[model samples]
Target: MRLWFLIPALMAAALGARDANAQQVHFDIDATLPVRDTELPYTLDLNLTAAAPTRIGVGALLDLREIQKIVPERMADNAIVDNCGLQVRLDDLSFQAQDETIGLDGGVTITIFECSRTSERDFQRGEQKRAILANMSTQATVDLRNNCAYFKLVDLTLTAPEAQREQLLEDDTLDSVKELMLAAVDLVLNETPLCPELPAELASLDPVYENGGPKEIGDGGLGVFLDGSVDVSPSTILDILTVLQQRKLIPGPP
Candidate 1:
């Protein structure tokens, strides 16, 4: 009887020790985004900021070189000669605990380096009309894909000084500009996975995208999915989550 009691006590102590060690484990994260192109808008010269704060800021740059490449008909009247570039920066970035999605509040800025266009007939181009936008909010969803986690940009609001804002709104390029910026940000998030490569211990966890596509945590920024959380063991998953939650990479229980 005495031996049996001692065995159970020792096992309990060992389990506790393992949990403690898991919590203390540290993971190095790299959020550097790679250059990739999307066919949607004939965007070329896609690049992300070489250096960015580990948390979030100036993650990527969007260069739209040809309006015709994005829309063939647009070329009839206008020729994009100099190309347009947009800088994406997110500040005060945080993760929401209740829902495991990241959110950016008012610290999101999109600065446009005006892309010059020439009227097809005039063959003369005006200087680029640069615009700096600030004080906007957006949210991101995280998904584990191909051995890493990817963040998807979902919501966005573009702002600038009254004069610049009006000019941007009036221009026909606003929608495409917004789309490119959001897409670039999404690519950056994918680059910055919680773990650059998923550890083998957590391999059993399968990605859960409700529509049989990629899994998502929230709604209405880049895309949406029905609600279902990734139920996982504390030892493997919690270890990484603990570190990221502290760094504001992922959310913690409220």
Candidate 2:
């Protein structure tokens, strides 16, 4: 089956900023990420050569912790609004800046087995909607990079899929999906990082996905965060990158 694997965005994110990134020192870090029983953890055989990798598995764990650090002592009670409402009291994400990596170096190959929830979902007879994501438990090789870490994915293999839906492994389906994923990774790795453009408020109570409505959600995305955050964390930067993608602010790198 030819599944439309969307990378959750306005446009497929691209690799960019090569010239602006030349002078910096690079680090190549590798790791074996943790995985759920049914899911296949990726062995990030990353060859960053000279860029910092955004280990999503690592970022998710770290970011979650960071966000939790600032949960206000007495958070304000959420107010109910009309229609769809999501009340998220976000604390400023806290991370020890010292933990950041500067680059990727050395011939490294790391395996990651991330955790996943295995369950059978009953698809409605006439419905064709399916969701494929989970909170991943990732592990990595500690401190291979000297200081700053540049990231790369040399070879990554995902080992989990729906057992009953066994058609995913037919022919080049897995390779095709992996290629697309790594392309996005290389885009970020081989260049300067895509910085988030958070608002001055840092956090807010806002109406999400108000404009897109419901029907268009599947075409690209339509949930509240779909405006941007649907793909990236907090969905804020996702909005910024969407504009950039539309304007071609970040062009593709060779």
Candidate 3:
């Protein structure tokens, strides 16, 4: 990812003012972040302006499929498998961005085995494949301290096919099965931190935000927006110098 930082020339006027504490520097960043090892593009637009408390705003759009890639293909709890008498494996994962939620399609394979048979040999009975659909409401948060973003789950619902729903109810394990699949999805989304590689110059700015960010879901992806600020005081300058020196982008003092 390449980040372009545009600092307005007017900021010099503040630095020259009598009140040093009133001086502030603004930053504008626009960049396209490519998903790791993939050609997919994630757009990011951020703005931090000078104000009484300083203000920052960010907008980002990431393809939903890229998020699917991060989730594990095989996630099965041993206890659940044993109690349910089924071996589960997540075969494929797909996603779609809806009006206010992201839709998930998970292809799952279940192997039914004889629970009564303790023998390791020939205990398998048969296999069945099913498609599970889910819709999720989420919120985005920017973590400048960690230099990353996180998706927080606001709500989740399983929209299973009618036939599968009947089967699930008949099997008397609907709740357990739903819990298992949802847990897998939650693990990948909420627990996993998303850190987009940022240029050292932008990273050194020490971006900060106050509240939960806003997001838009559409165009087959998730768009996250954040408003925050960056300090430009002497301490901030020193931090930038330290970062540049550590990255060997500039010479360090002897």
Candidate 4:
């Protein structure tokens, strides 16, 4: 009897120790987006670190030279050439994590300022226009712990304010701005040529159309409300969530 009681106690203590160690760790994530309607394809990669309850950092790399190549030829009328890479930084994160979920106790933020290039045609004659190529990244402070993986980005606001959109178009580029807005949303959602179906509300955003296609309303911006979220996890988390949840991590839903 005495030995049996001692065994259980010892096991409990060992598990608690393991959970603490797993809480803080570093991770890496990468994915490629599909070619959206009239939009260039690109790849995204990032490094991140999590230190307990609310500290997270996301380092990023992006390549968008394709967008620049197409604009000059296709929309020559409202043409301002833009081509460059992007860097998405997300930090100051505060969140709570549970089994297969990480909820934002604090909002996540990602911003890309006026960080793109313009074509020579943009500088010709009385050309007084500048294109602000940016895709603001949203923060993910949602419940994201399931098994040993982190939560994947499932969604981001798919629209930009009208004022912001106008600011992005320099010269004739603005003429095609409405169409490009859909492409911009496609870039963020990693929507490939085979872009997946979005949630219904997102699909029905347009008052005059509903091809389940991306659209713009009132100048806010064009966006792709993704069908789901992103999943991210470091190795250390598995040891902790396993011990804390008192169960094995289930694999993806059948």
Ranking of all candidate structures by their TM-score, best first: 3, 1, 2, 4
List model 4 lDDT by residue over 154-177, tens digit each: 444323347765543443333343
What is the per-residue lDDT of model 3 for residues 113-210, given as tens digits with 9 covering 90 to 100?
54455476534444444434422222333333354566544443444457567776776544665566456545554544444444655565565554
Top candidate on TM-score is 3
RMSD of model 1 against the true structure: 16.9
Better of 1 and 4 by lDDT: 1
The alpha-carbon lDDT assigned to residue 58 of candidate 4 equals 30
Task: Flag the better candidate by lDDT, 1 or 2.
Answer: 1
Please report the candidate that would top lDDT against the real structure: 3
How well does candidate 3 match the true structure in TM-score terms? 0.54
Superposed on all Cα atoms, the candidates' RMSDs to the truth, in angstroms, are 16.9, 23.3, 7.6, 18.7
lDDT of each: 0.37, 0.25, 0.45, 0.29
Query: Model 1: clashing residue pairs?
Result: 154-221, 154-222, 155-221
TM-score of 4: 0.22
Model 1 lDDT per residue over 93-211, tens place: 43331234445454444455644456654443334445455455566555545434455667776565676666667774456555765666565455444322223433333323222
Off by over 4 Å in 1: 1-99, 106-128, 196-254
Q: Which regions in candidate 4 have their CA more than 4 angstroms from the true location?
A: 1-36, 77-236, 239-254
If both were scored by lDDT, which would come out higher, candidate 2 or candidate 4?
Answer: 4
